[model samples]
Structure formats: C-alpha cells, structure tokens
Target: MKQWIFLVGAIISEVVATLSLKAGMDNSIFYIVVLIGYVLAFVFLTKALKSGMALGVAYGIWGACGVAMTAFLSHLIFNEPLTSIMVLGIVVIIAGVLMIELGSQAATRKEKGNV
Candidate 1:
C-alpha cells in the first residue's frame, strides 16, 4: 500500500519535472520546479523500492505513467500536438507496462509457491 503510494508520487513527480523542463524553456524559473520534481521523484521511487515493491514493476509504472501524463498534459497546457499516432504509442506503452506488472506478479507467486 505504502509502496503504491510512493510509486504514484514518483510518477507524478517525474511528469511534473518533464513538463517543467519544457516550460522552463520560456521562463527559467520553472527550472527550479524541474530540479525539485526530479529529485523528489527519485526519492519517492527509492521509498517505493524500500517498501518491497519490485524494481521492474516500480520503474515500469513510473516511466509509463509519467510519459502518458506528460504527453496528455503537455497537449492541454502547452498547446503541444497530441496526434493519433502519439496516442497509440501511449496506449502501447500502457499495455507493455501492464504486461510487465502481470509478469512480475506471476513470477513472485511462482517463487513463493516454490519456496
């Protein structure tokens, strides 16, 4: 539970950081947010790992969610393009992450059964 919370924080942070990186191109002050966001992202990710979340699952979720949210939000907030192809790519990323998560769960269950 705590690990999932931490992972969510990490994903949000990474997305914020990525978006800030783009916004910072106009106003340098956004760079501060970018730095803080990325740092906190890693910190939360570490907490998630320490809370017994598998690294592959944690990173897969973080990266995929971060990419999805960043792209969507960038389209809304920054007037960036959200073409159909990009949306498809995001969907594929989400599907890949889901598969990774399921595989990790099955592997964990198998290991526990073996033990």
Candidate 2:
C-alpha cells in the first residue's frame, strides 16, 4: 500500500516535470520547478522499489501513466491537439502497461505457490 502511494507520487511528479518542460523553456522559475519535480519523482520511485514493488511492474506503470498524463495535460495546458489517433495510441499504451502488470502478478503468485 505504501509502495503504491510512492508509485503514484512518482507518476504525478514525472508528469508535472514533463509538462513543466514547455513552460520552463521561457521561465527560470518553471525550470526550477521542473528540476524539483524530476528529483522528487526519482526519489519516490526509489522508495517504491525499496518497498518491494517489482522493477518491471513499477517502471511500466510509471512510464505508461507518465506518458498518458503528460499528453492529456499538454493538450489542456498548451492547446495541443488530442486527435482520435493519439487517443487510440494512449489507450494502446495503457493496455500494454496493464498486460505487464498482470504478467508480473502472475509470476509473483506462481513463485509463491499461489497459482
């Protein structure tokens, strides 16, 4: 449970950092925010790993969610287009992440003789 919280924080932080990249390009303050966001993201990610979340599962979820959130937020914040094709791509990415998570859970269960 705690690990999941860390993972969530990491994902949100990464998304914020990524989104800030655009604003940071013109503002020094945003650049500092970007740096802090990324650093905190990695710190939380490390905490998640130390808390026993599998690396593959954690990283897959983080990357997928980060990409999806950043894209959606970008559309909102920067007036970027979110075309149907891009939406489809995001869905596919989410699906792939789900598959990875399921696979990780199955592998863990099997190792624990619960499968």
Candidate 3:
C-alpha cells in the first residue's frame, strides 16, 4: 500500500539521517545530509499518516525500526559496540512494537465490525 511505502521511506530516511549525525561529527558537510534526511523523513511520515496509517502503529514501528537499524548500522559503519545485552534490548523493543501494531490492527478490525 502507499501508506506502507511512505512509512518505509520515513523509516529509511530517519535511519540515514541518524547515521549522518555521527558522520557529521567528523565532517560538517554531512550535516547537510542530516538535515535533508530528517526533513524527508518527516515529510514521508506525514504522507503515511495522511494515507490512513494509524499514528500509534506508524510511530511505534518507526521508532523501533529506527533504533534497531541505527544500532546495527552503527556497529558496522562506526565500529560501535553491539553487545549481547543491547541486542536483547533491541529484540524486546521489536516485540513491544509488534504488540502495538497488533493492538492497532485489532482496534481497527473491531471498529469495522469484524470482531
């Protein structure tokens, strides 16, 4: 769906922007990427919202994915620590996001008289 695409764009944009922040620390030019990325991220997020994605579900997914991807990429790109405890925390965050998504779906279904 268009909404999902927009949401994914938002997520990827956010991740890139976040990573750029670290890169920006070493070089100021990356700050331009950071600014553009964040701007596009919000734009995509707004599009996703307008396309009928529930705010709770969209935001939850965005935040969780951002955290997970940022952590993994940071480890790969910056040699940042990716310890076991952090991995476990990422898993937990993902699980919680899943629950939020499921709950949102259930609520939508109920509203539609499907339950």
Candidate 4:
C-alpha cells in the first residue's frame, strides 16, 4: 500500500519536473527546480521498485499515469489543445496499462495456486 502511494508520488513528481523543464527554458532558477524535482522523483521511484513491485507493472503504471497527467497539465499550464482524439488516446493508454497490471496479478495468483 505504501509502495503504491510512493509510485503515484513518483509519477506526479516526474510530471512536474517535465513540465517545469519546459517552463524553465529561459530561466536558470526554474531549471534548478526541475533538476531537484527529477532527482527526488527518481529516488522515490527506485525505492518503490525495490519494494517488491514488479518492474513491468510498476513501469506501466508510472508511464500511463505520467502521460495522462502530463497531457492535462500541458493543457492547463500551456493552453495546449484538449481534442477528442487526444482524450481518446489517453484513455486507451490508461486502459492498456490497467490490463497489464491486472493480467500480471492474475498470472501471479495462478502460479501461486499451482504451487
């Protein structure tokens, strides 16, 4: 449970860092913040990964969550478009990630039962 929370935090931190990287294009101070955020994010992410989370499942969750949040943040911060196609793509990505997580869990459970 705690690892899940850490995973989410890591994704949020990564998104913030990525967005800040863009916003910091002309400002050294903003760049510094971006660097710090990225470092801290990775630190927590590695901890989560080391805490018994499967690599594929963890990464899928991170990628999907980051992509979705990044898109929303882009729209809110940079006024990027929120077209239907974009929304659809995000939905698809999220669904796929969820399937991967679920599938892996089911496989693990089945393997455990067989043992």
For each candidate, give its TM-score against the true structure: 0.95, 0.97, 0.98, 0.92
Q: Count the backbone clashes (under 3 Å) in each candidate.
A: 0, 0, 0, 0
What is the Cα-based TM-score of model 3?
A: 0.98
lDDT of 3 by residue, 1-115 (tens): 9999999999999999999999999999999999999999999999999999999899999999999999999999999999999999999999999999999889889999999
- Model 4, 68-108: lDDT tens digits are 99999999998989999999999999999999998998989
- Flag clash pairs in model 3: none
Question: In terms of TM-score, which candidate is strongest?
Answer: 3
TM-score of candidate 4 to 2 decimals: 0.92
Ranking by lDDT: 3, 1, 2, 4
Per-residue CA lDDT of model 1 for 23-86, tens digit only, reads 9999999999999999999999999999999998999999899889999999999999999999
Summed over model 3, clashes come to: 0
Model 1 spans > 4 angstroms off: none
Q: In terms of lDDT, which candidate is stronger, 1 or 2?
A: 1
User: How far out, in Å, is residue 90 in model 2?
Assistant: 0.7
Which runs of model 3 end up more than 4 angstroms from their true locations? Answer: none
| Residue 35 shift from truth in candidate 3, angstroms | 0.3
Candidate 1 lDDT at 13 equals: 89
- The C-alpha lDDT values of all candidates are 0.94, 0.94, 0.97, 0.88
The C-alpha local distance difference test score for the whole of candidate 1 amounts to 0.94
Q: Clashes in model 2: which pairs?
A: none
